[model samples]
Target: MSIRLGLQIPNFSYGIPVADLFPAVKAQAREAEAAGFDTVLLMDHFYQLPGLGAPDEPMLEAYTALGALAQATERVQLSTLVTGNTYRNPTLLAKTITTLDVVSAGRAILGIGAGWFELEHQQLGFDFGTFTERFEKLEEALQIVVPMLHGERPTFSGKWYRTESAINEPRYRDHIPIMLGGSGEKKTFRFAARYADHLNIIADIDLLPGKLDVLRQRCAEIDRDPATLETSVLLTVILDGYGAPSDIGEARSGRAVSGSPEQVADEIKRRVLDVGIDGIILNLPTHGYTPDVITKIGEALRPLVDA
Candidate 1:
């Protein structure tokens, strides 16, 4: 499915009581849906990232939050922007998404990546292997995940994981869309070329055009149409009234879009969509899901995707 315009709720620190956290999260998702956003994304991390806040800050479990979101909202799609593959067994993770699919009436999308957060692994007892190991594990994990999502009982023996004829029952749809997020050219692009339904590029803004080109080349090498795999980018946005901050789009070494809602939408079209990426996923890390801002963005940006 094409994720034309998506909202990513990367921060849950709304200064509310712990009991009210899910409501606050739902407010944003609902607002985004009203604003015409097609998908709602949550980060799949146990701890806050260094760029957003201290690791000890409030971070809800992603799938649980998504399950809750599924009950609370009607139409918007639900998923993690990209789950760290090292966090769960391939089989169980497949089961979880299947359950989410049945529960949400086929709204779940599996977005995964090679694990990157070392501290989470160190503290949580998951093996924090080298970069190579993580990708290998992700590769092996997909072998089980893809088949199971398609209603197959896959039995595989690999360097990292082995599944003994795993089965996922009660599927709402046979083909749950797979989106891979990362910037690694060799592994991520190749695997995405072969496997993913969408590719959410996690990289600097200036780097996107090149990434798109490489992605196209990768698809060509696989004898697949590049357009067949939808593409998007993850960006942070901070608005200054209805205009851009002077340093807007100055996010190569560092990344973010600080602008008025109209400007940010225009910049996305010019910088991202014009550069050939299919869609955009935005994160309002600093603003914490302000409703008006989300709506304004939706009103200004949705047409671009629809057009």
Candidate 2:
């Protein structure tokens, strides 16, 4: 399959006024769709981090933002980069996603992970358990979500959650693709290989092959087909005017896919051929999500792979 591209809207607490942010977000979503991106993702968070801005800042709720995007765009899929498992009950999360999928015309994906950001959870009065306990909670949440998506009444009693025959209405027309986000070698990758339709890993081109090897080994251990899982990387991109290789700064080196269109295209080819990534989610740092960059990349690289 040809590589799919996605756009990640980083949930930075905007120092700019909300009046400016809303229009920019809508415009960017529309621009991404017009650029032929396969998906658009939002980060799930309640409070904004320090240095980025204030604590109780202009952070938009993930589901509500997605609902707005569902009405605004027609083609691009909408999802959280990874929703915190402890944020909401699985049944309710499933129903919320079902509603989004229906409204978006079957363009919703569930990207979920074990809850992280201890400070946020602690401040928000949610349980911040041990790492193992959190993963256990995530596994249970998956059990609830998967069956509920299949139009079944799910009942579960687990360490972190108890649902009494929860039923989901307005059945989804298609199976909402489940995307597991994380690179934990032991538990996270194993869970992705076992259950997820797709997997999201951090964009470290050098470490990708090793990670894939680990994922394949885990898949083998569970007798799962490794190729069944679609692999994607979340890349932070910084597009700048073409410069000499020696002029590149260390800070921008691996943190982003910078340089000219040809240089970026070459890097993408390396990720596919050398690292074996199936897709990439390009995250622009600022509100500089221009359609030109997308067109340039698409023009340069999209035709090379057999779709």
Candidate 3:
């Protein structure tokens, strides 16, 4: 999937009552679909991340939410911004995403990463291995996952995972697109070139061009055309009319796009797209749940991404 302009719903802490949460999520997905967004994404985490909110803050499981969202909206693609590779067995993940693709009628993108978030791993009793170990696990996971998604039964044994002719059935498509998220020029970039259909670069705005250069080099190492892998950046946006400027912290402002919708669009063009990045995915963690705000943001940014 070529995600020119995507909306990621990274926050779920609207002040509304608990019963209203899924309704709020549905509204955001429906509004994003209506406003010409190509995809809608959720974070794949058991708890909220550090910059977003406290760990106790409300967060829904990604696959369950996306399954429900598949029924709630039409046309827009669905996925996690990046599923933590450490969360589930590779075979199970393949089954889950293939099920999502079937339910969403072939609009599922498997966005994944080498899992981080040490606290979640600690509290949830997951193995938080060393950084190098995590990448190694991720590489092994992909070897099984990519084949399973392609309607192949792969019998594999590895350091971290093992699968015996694992079968994934009821697939909506012969292949579901895989998008790898990260800025690692060594491991992530090389893996994206090797197996992924898209690469969502997660780095500072200033560092993007250099990252892109290294990504090309990685692709060249494998003799793969860089264009075969689509690229995008994730932005934490604070629209001017939605909330006060102080809602954003000083640290995040370096990567955030905060301004009027028009100005936000302009800045994204100058900062992300003009840097030779293919597209952008925005998350308004503080204010995007409001349907009107989602519509406005989508209206302003849609033209920039439309071919």
The model with the greatest TM-score is 3
Best by lDDT: 3
lDDT of 1 by residue, 137-161 (tens): 9999999999999999999999989
Tens-digit lDDT track of model 2 for 232-293: 88776555652223322322545466666677767877765447778877765532444465
Q: Using Cα atoms with residue i matched to residue i, what is each candidate's TM-score against the true structure?
A: 0.95, 0.89, 0.97
* Alpha-carbon RMSD to native, per candidate: 2.4, 3.5, 1.3
lDDT value, residue 114 of candidate 1 = 92
Arranged by TM-score with the best first, the candidates are 3, 1, 2
- Itemize residue pairs with steric clashes in candidate 1: 242-260, 243-260, 244-259
Query: In model 1, what is the error at residue 165, expressed in angstroms?
Result: 1.6
TM-score attained by model 3: 0.97
Ranking of models by lDDT: 3, 1, 2
TM-score of model 1 (CA atoms): 0.95
